[model samples]
Target: MQGSGGPRKTLPELLSELDTMLGLAPVKQRVRAMVAEMDIDRKRRAAGMKTAERSRHLVFTGNPGTAKTTVARLLAQIYRELGVVSSGHVVEAQRSDLVAEFLGQTAPKTRAVCESAIGGILFIDEAYTLTEGDYAAEAVAELLTQMENRRDDLVVIVAGYPKEMDEFMEANPGLRSRFANRVEFPDYSNEELAGIFRIMARGQGYELAEDLETALPQRITRIPRGRGFANGRSARQLLEATITRQSGRLATMGDIAPEALNLLVANDLPAPEDSGVQQGDGGARRSLAELMAELDGMIGLAPVKDQVRTLVAETRVDARRRSAGLKVAARSRHLVFTGNPGTAKTTVARLIAQLFRELGVLSSGHLVETSRPDLIGEYIGTTAPKTRAVIEKAIGGVLFIDEAYTLVGDSPSDYGPEAVAELLVQMENRRDDLLVIAAGYPADMDRFLDANSGLRSRFGATVTFPDYSDEELAGIFEIMARSQNYLLSHDLRQALPAAIAGIDRTVGFANGRSARQLLERTIARQAVRLAAPDVDLDALPDEELQTLHVGDLPVA
Candidate 1:
């Protein structure tokens, strides 16, 4: 709170700002209703009438950059004006500040955070993240205790995506019971977003072109809107970028009038491809020849390579058929990659993501990698939402679930099955927009598929990544060493195959990983030998210093 000496905004002024906000009609309406209810309650109290108790704690649901925080800040001030809280200040925190990474620290951390917000609003952004594990559970428990104890003065606002917030409330019975005031913020419409862009430009003392308003909404409509889309913030970011471009354009001109300097035109705004508002073709553009060349250059996985080529060919053929007005049958894009650790399952998955993007099968070539622990939650009612969150992020590209076999379990109480069930639902719901690649050991993956009939049916194609041979391992080691600017001595090159052969072919032995580890160990040993006291470092040539001798190799 500012001191009495500083000027303050009155309740009407705060409400005016809230009402003038571009979008968020429901949010504005709800806020106005709350203010009206509070005002009537105040009058009733003056008339010696009883007032019903209402929960001031709120749950704000929306995507990113929907003015939730802005509204929260305004609501804090409004609460102070209405004598609901002592201070109009807000203390912002996420899971890290409240939840400890280790044991026993979460309660105190959470309590201290709540104590700081005793007289105002405690705004928790991405509150859904707090339902992850036992540590987060401890934070929620302490938060609930603080909310109950400081009911009079503190207003706790939890904000996140609509779906996750619902799951978060259900995760704890106390949370649903306490946070009764739910306000939803929807994504800004094209017209609302254009208005926001214009307001931002005007606020920065820049003038919009006469035609920009009409052109801006069309541009906004073209941008790919995914789960991570920032409705209001995207417009601001574009305005900033456009301002930079406008300045650049002005710099090249011989002379400019002072008034003309701040004027922006449609051409000043970056094209949709160049603006980076979404993953554009500029980043995802890759020739099929280049991708196939890179795949062929990999040390092994011939079968995997063939399978990938077939998938690409099939996608191309399907696209051509569709273009020619032929009805192409719907085919499953999901896949199961079976292999041991370090067999380049992830590497292949990333290549496939890029390939699919290039072929227009996916919107973005991005790859989201997750494991069993990342999807499954420690508590009940947590797994489905967590899995859906992962799927949401991977909508434009690939969801690569590594060691996916671990998602299958015999325990009835286990959350692994819950994650799998959610994956099946999201996989079907978002099939056209999402590519799911599940990778694990062959035997476990077979069992995983058998555990769920939907999994087996959805992932119709399986690509097998075989363990690299001794020769292939040697080739991989040489390529890695050379790529890092290190050369293998003649003697070391001769001993490489023998060293690779000596490695145990036990279950879960990392094939390519072993080769990488060997290279790293050899480099470390080389560094040690070079740093010997007897060695004159300055006298050695660059080649000698970078070479890997047989003595530098770690024993297999």
Candidate 2:
């Protein structure tokens, strides 16, 4: 009756708003198409068509930071412009907001949310979490009943992990029919991730170095080659980490370069370092026998050690045959090192690079370790150059991408896919000189491989890194303490295993790296205690610094 919000200018306004946002073209197109269709249908109905349809509900299944919520907000504006609703407001809710503690309370909570979302879009994020318990199930059912009755007045969108979303739909048969249109938000490909990075960087007024631009994409391509658990979420994490590092460096430099203000330079992204662990130059030239002997002195990596030895042996045989004038085909350039943190994936990568250098497969064999942020650039066209720079740096050596699957995000339109396209080309061309290793959680890696056929073909090896057992974690803690010149008291040693076991029982805290974090925290706490004003360092015995008791460590 209000002439569809001043002649439907909001649809164009929404598109214009998103075009400037960067790395969301696919999503923009989809939204535009939906809005146009809805507008056309509305006009036909007003001109006297018997059937007039309401706004369509959508399901967005993907990880965080893939622009789901951003798109949902824009869709609200489009719906209002198409005469489907009066207000264009977009209300967001998570499981916590909808599900209450007591029985019957959840329904009212969910109803209230829906009522507020009337004449607009209701976006439920992490929607699968709500179906986990009985209270959540009741909330979901009540929400479904409301959707059926208010289909003409509101739009509802449910989003979550792909598998979890399927399960959520299965839990309620009525929901499947109610949410007829499903829009899958695939993870961003590497190119898209790079595009997102470029966008973010530009927004902050930073310029990337030319060399970094060439090398970054190759790094991005190598990200999801083997491991499964990483995806677009990982890409976003890398960006955040890079930004933190850049900000720290900027604070030290006083004023950043005007051109570089929107860019990420190579120096801004440094390879991860290990404290108090030095691998000498001679260590790089060591023979397989010598390398194994050196590795023997390192503690609590038996599984990884065994796998490395086997791989080394096979590479050695191939190298010898090639040197003797026998033509041996080059081995696959892809490797999957599957292990939780602190199992030494980075260390292993460094060792492998050195090994390849010794065998003459690569010229320098230096290792370039990067996550998604390294490849993603901050503008629409800049992603290609930024990703290319990362590949260039890794050209003569090994490129290790941690949590590689982060190259993909929740939507097909995410800029990460573009980065992947660029990466796939470089990987094919640099197969002889470059070795790419991707590591992440198993399931995510599988999904990543499923998304790209070329990635599956290139990655031939898959290595699994299992979490450390409680006993193994205890041994690791003892090793770390000894290296730091600290001795665990008898009681402390006995209590360590129980503490580690308790930590492992907690969700997301069972990794081998968890033990190392605990040990580090304990040392810091002990140092603080020793530095107290009441405890004079000059008066304290040397043994006090050397000794660590159960009280020195935090309780699990």
Candidate 3:
């Protein structure tokens, strides 16, 4: 955009690049049509003929990672070359970029973003989010006014899911008339994804360890495509993940030659189950073995893991006995998880839902996590309806009610009893498909369960989560650092464990959460030391980029 401070390519050269681009035939056709229409309009104006009014604003509807933003940027450059806009820059903004926290702050924020894109295109990503709240409405209104204010020099493009985009346009009359030009970006096929993967790998100077012509495409196709499926982006993620796995695989070796440095292996490719679903069926359940593996992968939950394994075994045996026409024991699928925050209770609950789905106890492995505010209502008689609505949403899945004790407070007008009554009715009615898990502090959760005899009788099992020790916390910190592409130096490593060991872990002390905060703060401290404003970032050494020394660690 704006020629990027370089010699600009001709329009024919740009068109040729589009022609050679993989997939997007429909998009190419639309671009050609727009070019022809604009060219004719120019010629007609020169001949003193009348012309119809047109809007340069557009809407792009598609799933994630289908190159919508890429195409939009190219279109901005083309528009500048064609004199449709004075500058060919693209300013990208999301809801967070426009909407401010307070009521009066949104208009100025939206206007500033719009003004920045005056001589260019303003690209609003996930534009459907503008219809979410009253504040977002203010942003949308401000955007429309700005679009009209700078109509001569600026264009706007809004991108999101097809259905959501349609609804967004219909929800506002101004949006319908202004953003009339719509282009649909189709999801990339397996062949197209493989093409993108190869281009990305080669651009980064990496070569595949396996045959790209056959094995690569097959591997990509086995990953399931759901509603929010990131088509091209998923392929890129796979390639990056494979590279990370390759690095881990090579780390144990003594040393590697220069030749083997950029080679990605077939074994590094993510397996089909790695995508978290079975291909060919959107609702296919995970296998029991796969769920077990997933549960076992968590960092430090020995007791919870053992309980889940035993439950899985018992459920499978019970199913076998039932199939053989023998008397089978019945167990309540509901549960209670008692632990401090960030102790992996919620994570385990999610895993339990997947396990139950694999065990044929539930139709879907979905988990609806909620809190007291989500269940209880504010008004005189609205609590039951609110509670019922939540239960209805969690039907055919696990309903995870976090901080259940908060529902009951020390007030006579409290609606906790009403919400609880409705929840009990739904739990009994939807017993076949719904599984409820009430999770919170150990003592508070016991009180919550004791509040209703029915809830106490139904949730037959409790899985207690133990807080992580300082040693375990250090391991977590190392994992977090590695995931974020940073390495802890020996000095830093030596300091972190001892610092974490001295942390005050009382009632309010979140185990893994505190460790994560420490890790992030350490990274921030690293940036503070190394990320100077006057430094030439491109000239930084690789070791400097990777290493975090003792100074980065906080003094506990």
Candidate 4:
């Protein structure tokens, strides 16, 4: 609901935007019907006649990245403009936000989230999780009760995979009745995805080479739309990875022209494995060489990459020794990753999972990211089972416990200790299958280890991620700019480094974090310049549109 009373895009224009979306023509038609119904209802109210009561609650069933969340945002604004709600804000929630481990906690949490959307929409993503157990059931009850009371002012939209959402609605007696306004989003076809790729690339100021115009669609069509196919999202990710590969390919070449920078040739499209693109998992896993090459392609983290290489080398040697009937110890799958913020710990952790999976160490490479808060419980006796459940969800792959040292609270009766005890038991019990990585500040992590004696032997490999250097910071900023279709002017290359040097590398020198913030600031400034009142969209040429001048840089 931007521009509430001011002149903004009209309802018809907004509807046109919806019409332009890649797939789901049926959803578009339904939305148009919804808008028409709202118009008629408003007319009836104006005529001083009694109007029938209607529920705005909706159930959006779709696969991942089919734009359910995007449409929900648009619907919120349309609801506000049509006088259906007050603010037209949208509050999004996941299962973790609503459900709690202990009794008497979930109602308040779910209620708080609903209160935030008092005059707007409350979107519950993966709402099927609400029917899992008694705790989530209590949350669902709270939600239904709130909706009953605030029928006119509040709108609720629950979304999930089609089958699971169906089961969820059928299992709950009141859910299906309340969410009668349902819409199902269909995944995009290969041709539609190819169109999405072009739109994304042009938005980012890059153009697919002539060969890619044909080859991209073929490759996109070849990819199986199975378990994890995300339609347009898959295409977007492929373009990003391809652009990164292009940058890597050009890094060794000198004197790249500005035109050459925006052109992505067929050579730039990354190989399937190197791009982390899953073509519905082949029976054979990625080779060790392929995984290693992907690791080498990452921008920073020289030390982390070296450590992985060393580990892989040691494991390879041990495999040979065992083949000859010599005694060898099992490779420790647990790790302690310590670093400051923006140090790429999470990214490296995910890559480690993938690398191990490639080498036949784990069944899957999915990284489950959670912290101590996700594992601990409010009540005294409820923490262990909650912690066990968290471990259970991460059986065959990596369980990355970020800021894990937070589990050791300062108070004596803190339930964090109970959670940690349960975690230790699970870590050893499933040591053969699961790989757990505990990550946080170096000192706090060491202290956490000192507190638990058994953890030291299990998590033997400790990898330290160093902060990015000033030059590396500049490189990161450039990469960010290039990825977004902006090429920095020569003056900004020098100006950016000077600005970064003045960023006060003392207490809060967020390395990659500061780089991203800087890039965003520059983009905002560039938009202010390019989008001046006199500029027209039709007249804006590609050259002026893509160039980010030194004036966009912050004053140092």
lDDT of each: 0.84, 0.70, 0.79, 0.80
Off by over 4 Å in 2: 1-9, 16-33, 52-55, 218-236, 247-264, 272-556
Give the TM-scores of the predictions, in the order they appear.
0.61, 0.49, 0.51, 0.51
- Candidate 1 wrongly placed segments (more than 4 Å): 1-159, 162-175, 180-276, 280-285
> Tens-digit lDDT track for model 4 on 1-556?
1222223456887788898888778799999999999989999999987778888999997767789988987888788888898877788888998888898999998888888888888989999988887798899999999999888889999998765776688667998788889897866665677788899999999988987775675455443343355767888888888899889878989999888889998888866555544543323456788879978987778999999899888767765675555798876779999999888898888777767665545545667889978888778766875777667556546889999999988899889889888888877765644789999999999988887777788796999999988888888888888898888887877677788787767787778888898889888888898888987956889877888888998675
Instruction: Specify the poorest-scoring 10-residue window by lDDT in model 1.
Output: 1-10
User: Where does the lowest 10-residue lDDT sum fall in candidate 3?
Assistant: 275-284
* RMSD, candidate 3, Å: 18.7
The candidate that wins on lDDT is 1
Once superposed on the true structure, which residue ranges of model 3 sit more than 4 Å away at CA? 1-7, 210-213, 275-556
Decide which is better by lDDT, 1 or 2: 1
Give per-candidate clash totals.
0, 60, 0, 0
- Judging by lDDT, tell me the better candidate of 2 and 4: 4
Ordered list by TM-score, greatest first: 1, 4, 3, 2
